[model samples]
Target: MKGRETLSNRFEDGVLALLPRLRRFAIGLSRDRSDGDDLCQMTIERALSRRESYEPGTRLDSWMYRIMRNLWIDEQRARQRRSQTFASEEAGVSIGAVGGQEAAVEINDVDRALTSLPDDQREAVLLVMVEGYSYREAAEIVGCPVGTLNSRLVRGRDALLAKLGEVA
Candidate 1:
């Protein structure tokens, strides 16, 4: 009982400490403040609820990030499915009219470019560029050899440059 209590306290402290970074990550994934807040809340709730699944001495932040990433992917899939039914209707809506239109357009362009990338390249860009992970850390997170990660980074950068051209 004492051991469990101590572990719980530590986990709570860790989660509290990581909240700001987690929120930032969620915001990057969601692109909406409300959605990001919800995602962060969901992540914290899930982490606390499943505390037993966490291995002590492991990288809690990485584990939490994986969970958050999976959740975001699932949410994106759900949104895709929902949008499919209204795709034609939504298609006519100009991206230009969105709130923060210019910024949204830029984000959309980046997202489209990102989606066009091969999976490994996209993942590498997201991990290193968006999330600020070091190359070695990203390689570990993506479960790839360092050389492979370097190759992906080079290819992805070239692809982005080609897509963005002089506009970026």
Candidate 2:
């Protein structure tokens, strides 16, 4: 009983510590705040239900991110099949919602530029830049070769610079 209690507590702590990042990643993937919240909720539920599958020594953030990414992919496919018009909806929330300040507008511009990248490139950037994962770790999380991950980052960066101008 004590062992189970300790394990659960540790898992909860690890996941809770990552709540902000997880929510932001969820928003990045879904492009909609409501959907992002749903994804975050789903990730937490899955993690709790399958706590035993979590390896104690491994990076908890990576595992949780993998769960969120997989769920996002699945949701995308499901959405694609349901309506071809869904792409239009992916433009995401308005900039005003981020904040009324100028800095928020710049942040929104960056976010919009991020949305312009291809899905693979966006994922690579999210894991490497946003999540601050090492190259090898990001590659592992994205399930791609290191070279491929590098290419995606390069291309994604170039695209962002072009889309958001030199300020990016």
Candidate 3:
């Protein structure tokens, strides 16, 4: 049907428009660019395949994020069952030249600080601080109460500041 085709085209466009944000979230979760790319691709594929289930006029970004988070959790469980560890620091080395050493170092330090947080805290920080999600939206994404999300954010923010020596 022409109507269905049009809707599909629109959905695809929406998904495409969200690719960069999704990729960034994936990379933040996986902590390796290669794995993050794979996760991002998987999320896009799954969203496209399941487009029929998506409700029109709802938050498409939220739907995509739920899919990504579910997939990441599944992969993590599988890896745990297989006794696979995360890649080493060397494995996370950036491929391209640094744009600026000072900025790069600061970014790396923040990333390192984030990685040091617990999984829940990291997710909280990523969704709120990094992705700019509202407390209610992020709480919904992570399937937690807004109060819990706020608590996690507070703890995560404090830990990051401590790790970065930003608290004098």
Best by lDDT: 3
Global CA lDDT computed for model 1: 0.86
Better of 1 and 3 by TM-score: 1
lDDT of 2 by residue, 30-68 (tens): 889999999999999988888899999899999999999
Q: Between the candidate structures 1 and 2, which one is better when assessed by lDDT?
A: 1
Error of 3 at 14 (Å): 0.1
Question: 1-168 in candidate 3: lDDT tens per residue?
Answer: 999899888999999999999999999999999999999999999998889999999999999999999989877865763443344567658643467797788888998999999999999999888766668768978999999999999999999999999622
lDDT of each: 0.86, 0.85, 0.89
> How accurate locally is residue 107 in candidate 2, as Cα lDDT from 0 to 100?
86
- TM-score rank, highest first? 1, 3, 2
Q: After superposition, how far is residue 160 of candidate 2 from its true place, in Å?
A: 52
- The collision pairs in model 2 are none
- Best-to-worst order by lDDT is 3, 1, 2
Better of 1 and 2 by TM-score: 1
Lowest-lDDT window of 10 residues in candidate 2? 84-93
Candidate 1, superposed: residue stretches over 4 Å from native? 86-168
Candidate 1: how many backbone clashes? 0
